[model samples]
Target: MTSRNTRHHTVLAAAIATATAAALMGTALTASAAPRPTAGSGRPAAAPVALSAAARTGLLRTARAGLARTAEDIGLGAKEKLVVKDVVKDADGTVHTRYERTYEGLPVLGGDLVVHTSESGRTEGVTRASKATLKLATLTPRIAATTAQKQALGLAKDKGSAKATTDRAPRKVVWAAGGKPVLAYETVIGGFQDDGTPSRLHVVTDAATGKKLFQYQSIETGVGNTLYSGKVDLATAHSGSSYTLTDDTRGGHKTYDLDHKQDGTGTLFSQDNDTWGDGKTTNAATAGADAAYGAQATWDFYKDTFGRSGIKNDGKAAYSRVHYGNAYVNAFWDDSCFCMTYGDGTNDSDPLTSLDVAGHEMSHGVTSNTAGLEYSGESGGLNEATSDIMGTGVEFAANNSADPGDYLIGEKIDINGDGKPLRYMDKPSKDGGSADYWTSSVGGEDVHYSSGVANHFFYLLAEGSGAKTIGGVDYDSPTKDGSTVTGIGRAKALQIWYKALTSYFTSTTDYADARKGTLSAATDLYGADSAEYKAVEAAWTGVDVH
Candidate 1:
């Protein structure tokens, strides 16, 4: 984690400037270029292979175990019905798996839940399944990219003829991090070629060592401009929004609103040659800045804490658009883009573009991309709590000289219409009707407020019981048992939360389930009997969750 003093505004300002300028031309710029085909340009054919009966049964068992573990880490209960319907094996012995399950009795089905098992029968990898494969086999892409290298190549934008004359070829290789190989690529885009071609060379690198592995010219696709928009759609598919309408009320500036010309929900506004949050904004500049900061913060939080990068560990960059619509009152994460949006408050004065709010909103993307948490009841509370935890982690990561880390959300955005933070972790009830602890009735309330129990637990896990100052804010968090619970600090706490989120939680997580997830995650990160583990267990107890 970055120190508060060294980070904060400078890093945020840099991210904003970079993101805003990067968005001006609407082109993709990756760290590397795609590797050219070493063999034939024509599509390759797959060789047929077959699996034995024993192999089939073994693979199915492995898949079931992987699904169970994933569900457990994601806060989905053990009884959520992780059932494997069929398992098919190809000539290479690679397996295609399908399953049917229910989250609180909601029938759900998915496929291609790939699992790699070692000789000892221990699961090695569990990749996310494609919805199309799970929903309809015919809908799956015929040439779907499978490996990390293929995925990285698929993510880059076409650079056109400018890259054709590139004397430099992109390097390609797998970089090792935490014992796993990560595919990395690097390249320049939008630059002039020797012949003045309107393209740039893509460079690929080893994600672990930053080593250049390969380089290649991106094939120009005239539809390049639509690529980002398409990616945005793919990222936000799970998020319930139809379109992103820019807010141009004041001038040419914009706010990425939900629909074209929709009123009442637009988030930020532009004013006085500057972007301020007053419920409406003109462009994605300032809100983009806040979004960039929050995105980077959450990204860094996961990476530095748990050794993961971006949302997919694939070196993917987050997309953020500002100035949503006229007088919008909220910001949101559209799963289709794996990006977040901000809004100026009603009438365009208070933009919900604060760093904490940005983190809060962006975390939703992270959660969606990871656990696919359901958005109702106990699971909903866990989903909300996950956002709050990561949002606080972002503040802590900023280590900003101006805005420090604390238990408050939206302190800078002034969401309350007063000079106060939106929500308080120390005394969550400060949010008017937020619950302070777990109760049966809590599930019936709003997901945000009912999330207090988990939020309070996270705060206590990071800061312990005491009156202290952090990032210029004062907090005197208490314990339900009145027993001092020594925490593992914010950095480690954030790590545990993220691990639990990506590895342990499901859409049905509640307070008690959260307690188990963090504890298990702590044990996994540290040792089962380590101080960190004990602290996590105690922290939940302190919040009356254990």
Candidate 2:
């Protein structure tokens, strides 16, 4: 169900430090005064905070109350009802709480804002994603719901069943795509597409005119069974004589079975004893083990490498659901449920739950919470690339013996059943669908294929151009201009990428912006004139991103 248009992500900080007394004293700040620069524009830098364990707990406990007062202090209209979505407490005790707005009881799609608070319980600044006022002409739509549903169905790519089904009535929402709020009908169309892909299309149409405004498929497809990564240690909880598949060490991440259903969590994996599974798909526990291991490894990679507490950076682990749907051939990260779902492959023999696939899926959650790169155009490609890059990083970080790290993605999963990997980083175009270099039309390509540009840039930045060998795998990366770029090593490359993603890149950021962001990140981590910074610049140039 993954589409090029889906969008969501974690937080990126933009600090505006004005005296707290001024804000408390009722100083008027216009909406434009809120931090709204594209992520990585390098304005209003965020200040890191360090808070003790006890202080962090206390701050979270009072965050909701503070949000209400802060909303008023920040000039929010009385009608704007802000619902807190996430709260992040930095090490320095600065808390950034994300909020979604609703007007007259209808959800405001683009009116998300974040309120920053200091350790002393004072408002520091606010970062708003939408500057549009949420005043609509009317809540009731002139277009009938039936007509809207018909329009939505007409626009759907998959009209498998002459009539698409919806779970509920079309909801009224404020469409804010062009930075102005418009009364619209948000419709969900569920069915199978012409290409056999599952569809959970979310369509937004103008309520007054019935004109289509926006649409994106909600089903994210990306998974596995008998333990793909081989024998691995698992953290389990024992209650009486049965053990559950919950990892206490990694934020209590649990694995569940969807039992061939497309909706709801099926069952928590449990057994009578510690002995989990044989190396075969017949045993469901085997698939659960692989999923659990993947989550654990990915969690450890983020924590140990980037110092991120977890996927949300709040030390809260996202659970994993395996065996989702019947003979399904994909895996996805759903931010709404805050969990990862993996489907049993075409025949249930190849569950798409390999390490890299798991890493890739979970990284989507990371991207959703960070830059939230819009899943379309160049930004979408970068979003997919972020997942691939981080997934590869997790693989390398794990250094697992059975499934050793390689630049190839999903190599062991046999996703195509042809013994060929899903993608190759060194020569991305080798797959026949990916672009080896960037072009003006690159944004028009599928996100998975267009991701090659950034993937290539990362490869060149980390391992340089031309032939090389690492971890028993061979790679020959080519540059656009046939120039030989020197390596900055993967460690430094990962640091720059992570920093750029979390601190700089925004939803609308493109390839050019990515180049600038990585450079800024490199400058922050290394000297502006350091070799690592130079390498980053050269790598982007090598990918024709300049």
Candidate 3:
């Protein structure tokens, strides 16, 4: 269900980055990003790629070679090790290599950093998630791992349904996120959350102190197209005088039916006719069409806009599953199966299969693959906001007349029964549960509601501050300091965000880190003196992230 979120190949977009886009030396960084057409401008983006395989390999090699000196500068213990996680480059040949730290080979939570260097391998500056020097007195845990696992599962069962379970027992990790670094156990709980959404809750407990340290759910609420595209052509495969919802061009992406059940991939949709959906929830084909189309559009958006291959940035595509359960009301993306699942809403009348919803859910995959932002605190808010931002981008990129791009999310689904959207970007606070500005307590709220801050920031960055009507919808956006902000256009905003997510952001990146990462990304893409950079600063200020 995306209202919330395709492709033409080779000649697809004129302004987006392609899979083979070369690294052309530019003022922004190293990779070239041709200007993209703004939303509702009836244009598409199909520019060059981010960085070639050789460039990425070179960046990683440079980062690893200088790891000893870089770790020493950060005051790390001799036992600490740095491993390059991902590498991205700029148009000016600047490379940002993300690294994860390990203390005595034990994973260190919140101990990730991005090392920025010039094309000549000269180290510039480092953005560290945590600056703590990890050196524990002992590796043994006073509390048994089984004890921690039981405690975590018990808590998950409390927050989850009766069937709540854990796939793996608690494992040891260095909890360096807050205060002093301590040995802790990280437990992952799976099953349906209390609200019926699938859960990937991570619970961290102190091994020495016998106290729970942290817990977060990775599968938050967030997946497409036939139901929304309105008589559009589908890129399906032909099989024995029939058609199947299998797209080989986009990594053989397929759509399945859960058959009103809660488990498994269900069945693949097939028929004599290639056409799918009537834009109504009358048959199973309608929802299948929507889901398949959503997947296609999302794939195209990433490929054309950012030159992203797929959710994992590999050529492989993630599958989609619909008709998940009876009256399930919500849809979600699950990483365990690398697929999406949807529900039948309101006595199974509404499928929760809106275009934006599909885009929102699938964007969760994008977040998981890139920054892997922790699904808690300010970072979780950013995660949700990223989905909303990308979902909006998906709508615009599709350029569907029946559902043209808008700042409202889930507007077509009638989720609230009052024809109100699940969220509003221009003025997120208008939804009543979201925050309009950043606050210390924002982290404690639900990720969906706390996402309002980043959502408002993106809105200001792309649309500006004040009252206006866009896509036939009314909006009145305000600022924390009552200062006016100008938009830098959605196309540029998307570039800065994608660059930041892939390069500067880490798993524990909070709102503060997001502001910094995006500012740096803007500087890398448009230069420090450009209006886009200034607008990014102003937008974050408007959201009170400063």
Q: Each candidate: what lDDT? A: 0.47, 0.70, 0.74
TM-score of each: 0.54, 0.79, 0.87
Q: Which candidate is the best by TM-score?
A: 3
Total clashing pairs for each candidate: 86, 24, 44
Tens digit of lDDT per residue, candidate 2, span 79-164? Answer: 77776655555434445665667777778765555565666867766555455566676777888988878877777744443346
Reference-based TM-score, model 3: 0.87
Give RMSD (Å) of candidate 2 vs. truth. Answer: 7.9
Give candidates' CA RMSD values in order: 21.3, 7.9, 7.9
Rank candidates by lDDT, best first: 3, 2, 1
Candidate 1, 491-537: lDDT as tens digits = 66776776566544443345665666566556545556668778888
Highest lDDT: which candidate? Answer: 3
Candidate 1: segments with Cα more than 4 A from true spot: 1-120, 123-284
